[model samples]
Target: MPDDCRNIYKTCRKAAGLTQEAAAERLGISVESLRAYETGQRVPPNEVVELMVILYNAQHLAFQHLRETNALYSSVVPEVRPRSVLEASAKLTNRIFLFAESHADRRLLRITEDNVIDASERAEFNAIMEDLQEIVEAALELRCARESS
Candidate 1:
């Protein structure tokens, strides 16, 4: 309910890999209505939210499948000088810790509905940071091993 449901809806739709027109059709809504939601001119009804959840779930599954396949292929034909998992994870953990600590001072001002959205954003950001950390560590480890040879 925070940060403009319309914008959130639109983002979720895109994240689910749905074109505006396709999402509109699936939701039994007009393209104009979908556009309005994306443009922050209108909020979707609860029914639309339910539909979006379904769409997002589907998209997440597809993404997981793709990721797994890529990982499998990479294992067989690894990249040169890639970071190791441990190094990347440690880096991301440190970054998130710093960010959370820095933002701690502003927590008092972040009250109300906007705060909820901000919190969600922070969580998503942290997740991404952790992922990047893992990637970088893997790459670093790979690079070190190559150099040692």
Candidate 2:
């Protein structure tokens, strides 16, 4: 489903009002690389996909917050397409794991280690809980964007 991923990436990028070059710069990649990903000439690596998910979620949240404050009405609205909640959620889960693995703070490490023992008796599932929160928040924001349009 690389084509689907490319389409989703393009939609999210446009929704955030970011040109391919701008998005690539933000993602610390080359514009040609971003274009390749968008055109399905090359599939983004897992790390790049994770970065995209973070960017998409952050942008979605910003737009949602703007709309809530009625700030969006003052400007000319850009086109925004809907995103799949399930796909977003899955991406968020991957992002959380990536974050945890990369920046293993003591508190997070303890909580994560505890969760590995008997999933039902986990001491703190904050990471997973936060992932769920991001998913819900992103979905709500996307829904708001859709409804507003």
Candidate 3:
């Protein structure tokens, strides 16, 4: 319950088309308390979180908090947290770049005048691969930063 429920509370309340006063009334709490919970200035108790789940009729954000905080709840909800997500991402990302990088030598292939593709096409292909490499690297870095944080 110490986990911040700010975004979740706000989003759920908005999605349900309920005003802060209404949502707080449904939970039998004051609007000031609800605001505090949504502002991260206070942590709602477990019962309050459950009331949130009931009020919103969804628990996506609340469950995410539980998964990050309570290992006991996480184990009972194995599919809630997927393992090897990073490993799978790295494997696929590396394989894509490796294939493109290994094919760099292909840029040197000669083409007869009769060939449909000329030097321009070859250069463009190489350029595209280079761009793809950079994009892939950036994606991996962004993912690492997000997961770590």
Candidate 3 residue lDDT tens string, 59-100: 454565565457897665432221244654665577567666
Residue-wise C-alpha lDDT for candidate 1, range 1-149, written one tens digit per residue: 23423255666677668899998898888999888766766656656655665765432222222233356744443233223446545654675566566664254345333535465567655555554455554554444433322
Off by over 4 Å in 3: 1-5, 71-149
Could you tell me which 10 consecutive residues in candidate 1 have the lowest summed lDDT? 58-67
Q: What is candidate 2's CA lDDT for residue 26?
A: 86
Task: Superpose all Cα atoms of candidate 3 onto the true structure and report the RMSD in Å to 1 decimal.
Answer: 15.4
**Worst 10-residue stretch by lDDT in candidate 2?**
73-82
Using lDDT as the measure, which candidate wins?
3
Please identify model 1 stretches exceeding 4 Å from their true place.
1-6, 58-149
The TM-score that candidate 2 achieves is 0.39
Return the candidate ranking by TM-score, descending: 3, 2, 1
Superposed by TM-score, candidate 3 places the C-alpha of residue 117 at a distance from the truth, in angstroms, of 54
